[model samples]
Target: MPPIHLLDLSFQETAEAIAAFVVETDEGPVLVETGPHSTWPHLEGALHKLGYRPEDVRQVLLTHIHLDHAGAAWAFAKKGAVIHVHPVGAPHLAHPDKLLHSARRIYQDQMDTLWGQMEPIAESQLHTPADGEEIEIGGVVFRALYTPGHATHHIAWQVGADVFTGDVGGVRIPGGVVMPPCPPPDIHIEHWLESIARIKQAGAERLWLTHFGPVDEPVPHLDALAARLLDWANWMRPWFESGTPPEEVTPRFQQYVQEQLRSEGITDPQVLQRYELANPAWMSVWGLMRYWKKKLARG
Candidate 1:
């Protein structure tokens, strides 16, 4: 097995908040996630520290096409690296206008500052792998498992006994508390729960989250995340039925998350803010609310 090195992106000057993994394989080095384009410099510095250059990366595997995970993939694609992603996400990367437009509506003026420039990757360089597909790069075999819930295009990469779970497995800071990152536009609770079961059945020993580092206790971590997801979704179901404005729900959800963090011995305002940024309470509110609304419509 190749050694996986964690590269700290140092997001917002906070440690362990966002990370990219470097896998040293027999053929060469492969980068798992690129963090975000805004943090490309930090990624470059990390690569430099590991004695690698931008061009040194010949293959880049993405768990999803979310900005935080695959925003900088174009940078590597420009360096002649083949960008492998889910079929659902390949078109968006090839033509990023719609993707950027949607994100701009959410990020507004903070777009450039928060995500940096997102360039379009040539379709020729994009490889859309099917679910259950196995891709071997640099003598490393990665199995792409379609894990939808957080995002329809999301894929969890399984390498030997380890899995690179983008956002499908949820977020956890250094502390051992698991929190669901239920961002909107695509948050299917049923699908997500199924995805969690899929990951557990994979028998991975560890889960490498893009938000932070490796989680050694896979089963327990995933179980906690599943429970947290249902708890949050159930909490929002009533709020959705009541037709409470999103504005009010956002703050209430924030308080709820803050309380959870406090109980876990994380009370600092700054730390709480970092966790919020990683997985915003407002986004979860919107996501859960949307999920319920859609279910209700179907029923």
Candidate 2:
């Protein structure tokens, strides 16, 4: 098996906020999750530290096309790397104007600082793999499993017994507690739970989370994540039913998560702030609220 190296992007100057995995094979290096373009320089520096150049990447794989996960993918594509992604995300990557515009609505003035520039990947360089498709780049074989709920375009790549779970595995900052990154527009509790089950069914011995690093205890980690996901969704269900505005619920949710962190022994304000930045309470409120609304409509 080709060795997999975890490269820390140091998002927002915080360690382990986001990560990109490099799989070294005989052909060249294959990168998974480019992170936001804002941290491209850091990624380049990390590659250099590992004795590689940007042009050394021959293939780039994305678990999803969310800006944080794939914003800098075009950079690799520009270096002549073949970009592999779910079909649902292929078009947006090929023509990122819509994606950037949607993100702008969320980031506003912080756009450039948060995500940097998202270049469009030319059609020729884009490869959209099927749900169960296995992609062999160099000597490594990655099985793409469509794991939506974090986002409709999400996919979790499985390599041997290790799965590169994007947001499907939730966000865990080092010693901090794990939390669901339920950002808006694509949060579906049922889908998320089902995806978690799929990951479990894959029988992965380790899970490589894009939010941070590899988790050796896959079962318990996934179980805890599933529970927290349902717990957070249930917690927000009533807020939505009460017709509470997001702004009002955001702070309450923030406090609630902070309290949970405290119970888990994470009390440092700075560490708490890092969790907030990684998986904001406001975003969770919006996403979970949307899920409940859609659930009501479906019923």
Candidate 3:
């Protein structure tokens, strides 16, 4: 462990958003995620404050291709940093057409304001990680754990006991409770639970979450995450089962989540914003409903 220093570059005071890591490696400084584009200046400042230049970054490992995690990767790739990401996400980075179009639809006018610019990464700087492959950067070996519930291309980087669990381990609000961010289309409840089980079995010393910081009380937090995962599904499953539209289910799920946050003692508006950034409750509820609909249609 090189004592990875966390950079709250995203400035996520209003929402539970992304956190970038500056890992000091023998090779140089490596970045785990590069928040969104709007936060680039802050990220750059943070790097300088840490006694490093932006060019000091030699490797950038991304958990997935989501805009929040790998969106700003081009900023570093342009500076000669090699990007390591899951194979499923490699193509998207090379040509971000579909990714950008989809995001534009979701974020609408706020897309560019929030995410900044999403540039395509050159093929030379892109490295698709294989499961179980060990990447030794600056002498620290990180084993890529393919934990794909949050996203089909998600992976958790395991170095020693600290697993950089992107969004697989669930979102932990500031007050200490964990909840599932079930965004639509790919939010498979079964697969997500299996991934959680995998993390629990890994016996990690601490889980480094991208939304915020690390947590060591593994069992309790994992339990809360697991229960919430199921509870979210159970709460919304009935609505979809009754032929309720996704748009209709969204508010119900949001209420369910908001109530859960209140129960956990997170009463502040700022804290609520943070949780939203971690896992947009509406998007997740739609994802679960989409999965449910697809499964039922197939059956």
Candidate 4:
């Protein structure tokens, strides 16, 4: 049997929408990510169409507690889905005040429209996966790779040749091209590369992205992604070193990034927009620059 089933959350065409994966295990069905709560009905509908009731989904595996990935987790946990997330992320999911506040800072009034309500998970249901740990649910093995660069709490799930890379491998758009999602507060170039190496070491033949579906050619996609990440880091380092105003730096970075995408064969502007929506180019500029500043300050 296939290890997992793709639940098309119908958010793909909708604005601010994303995909979610459901892994059917021997014990029960395990959902890899819970999109925002507003999409909960759609998710439930998808699950039902797949022939399983909500309770049949006994466990929810989160690559991280980012709202898009884990927002609807609370709704499931309320229905008795055991929540699994990173240790660092467990607290935030258990008490969503910080998560909400941080998202509010970034998204402001668009919160409800962009990402639905984030409900709190009960402490008892929260399972903080350790690095290199293998979890077997109903005989299906899922090894958690502590891939932190997208976020300090991020994890990538591996099951045979298919690995569910949350944001660690970046977002693979409709055409299957990979792009880095260097969002703020937790984007570190060193750690992001390390995470990529970790995923490669795990030996997944295909990478399943949370933003969409399976990527068959892992090597070239990953190669392109790595080069772009480095290029972005290198491009932003000088700006940070020069202490350019954040206002001036962001727009400059976007142009450079857009040009890089064009060089890499992404010809369509709307395709670029999708990439921007999934992992805003501006955030990459901010995240790397901020990381550089923090690293320098520490020294």
Candidate 5:
């Protein structure tokens, strides 16, 4: 296993809310998850602490192209880094207007402060690796496992005996429960469960989550994530059917999730806030609602 240095981005001035991993490859340092551009200065400082500069990272492997995970990738690409991503996400990175527009709709005024700026990466710099394809950088090899439940273009990059599970592995901060981040436009529950099975089959020694950090126990962590994913989806079913406004469902869902956290013994206010930052309740409310609407329409 190559040396993996986990860099905390301290998203929203909150510790452990986001992370970017720098792996030592023979050729040079390869970065996984650039995090949002809002945290770019912090990420640079984290890299510098480890004696690396952004230019030293020639390869950027993204688990997915969401703003939080891959938003800052273009900055690395500007320094001549090759961006590795899923096929479906390649175009979006190369042409970010639509992606940016969608995100703007969700976060109007808070966009700049939350995610900073995102520019288009040249198509030449974007490499869309096939599922199970391995790319060797320096001497370390990274195998991309297609895991698309959190987002349609998500991939869990497996290096050595461990996996860098973007959002597919769920968000689990220290002393918090594992919660799947079900953001909209592609929150298919069935596909997500299958992806969980795929992660189990990968036989990783540990699951490296971009949301916070590593999980030593893959099976139990994943099982809990699967259960919670179903639990949250089912919890939102009746509300979706009742045509309840998301505003009404959001607070209830937030309370429900917080109570679960409180039960799990995470009483610290900051810890609870980190959970919300990593996986916002309102986003999940809409995401699950959309999932139910689509699933029922198919019946």
Candidate 6:
């Protein structure tokens, strides 16, 4: 296996909160994730340490269109890099106005401070690969696996015997348990389970997580994530049916999740904050509630 170096974007100055990976290949170096625009300086600094400038990167493979993962991709594309992403996500990256507007509605005043600026990448720079398609850069072969459920446009890039599981792999730091990041408008429980199965069937020896880093024990880590996804969604089902408002439910869910982390012996508040930064409690509340509502409405 070729070397895959991890770059901690230190999102909001929190280490292990977000990560980007650079892989060496015959063509030079390629990026896996870009963290977000707010951490562009950190990314640039990280690249500098690796003895390469951002402009030297020729290709970037994104797991999804989420701002925290792919927001800074345009910066690289500006320097003549090919941006590879899900077909459903390509249009959003090319024309980010709608995505920005939707995000602003949620983030409000914190938008600029939290995410920084997002600029559009030209359509020609975007390459939307089909599921199971393999794209070779330099000497590395990346096989795209359409692993949705976290987002309708999510992909897990499989390289050799390792797979970059993105957010679908769950958020976990050193000494912390795997917990799902269930952000709203696209949190389908059934589909997420199927995607977990898809990952398991891939038979990768290692799973790379964008929230933090790599898990050498792929099967157990994925199993834990799948179980927690169900646990969190089931916990929200009754709350959604009983007409519990988000404002009322968010804090309670946060406390419940905190207890689970505590039981896992993750006692440090700073470490707990990192988990929150990676996967917020309130977002999971909204996401799981939305999932139940959509399912019940269809039934």
Total backbone collisions for each predicted model: 0, 0, 11, 1, 1, 1
Off by over 4 Å in 2: none
TM-score of each: 0.98, 0.98, 0.95, 0.93, 0.99, 0.99
Model 1 / residue 207 / CA error / Å = 0.6
Instruction: Give every collision pair in model 2.
Output: none
Best by lDDT: 5
Of models 3 and 5, which has the larger lDDT? 5
- Model 1, span 9-116: residue lDDT tens: 987667778889999987788999998899999999999999999999999999888888999999999999999999999999999999999999999999998898
Give the Cα RMSD of candidate 4.
Answer: 1.9
In terms of lDDT, model 5 sits at: 0.93
Q: Whole-model Cα lDDT per candidate?
A: 0.90, 0.90, 0.82, 0.82, 0.93, 0.92
Residue runs of model 5 more than 4 Å from their true location after superposition: none
Tell me the tens digit of each residue's lDDT in model 3 across 82-180.
999998999988899888899899889988877879888999999987888999987898889898777889999888888888888877765647877
* Residue 287 CA displacement from its true place in model 6, Å: 0.7
Model 2 per-residue lDDT at 101: 97
The residue ranges of model 1 lying beyond 4 angstroms of the native Cα positions read 268-270
lDDT of 5 at 192: 96
**Cα lDDT tens digits for candidate 2, 1-299:** 67989999988988878899998877888899999999999999999988999999988999999888999999999989999998999999999999999999998999999999988899999999988999887777999999999999899999989899999998888788678899888998889999999999999998898888989898889898999998998899899999999999999998898888989999877777678777888899998998899989999
Q: What tens digits encode model 6's per-residue C-alpha lDDT throughout 1-299?
A: 97999999989988989999999998889999898899999999999999889999989999999999998999999999999999999999999999999999999999987898999999999999999999998878999999989999999999998899889888998778999999988998888889999988998899889988999998898899999898888889889999999989999999999999988899988889899898998899998999998999999
**TM-score between candidate 3 and the true structure:** 0.95
Give the CA lDDT, 0 to 100, for residue 126 in model 4.
93
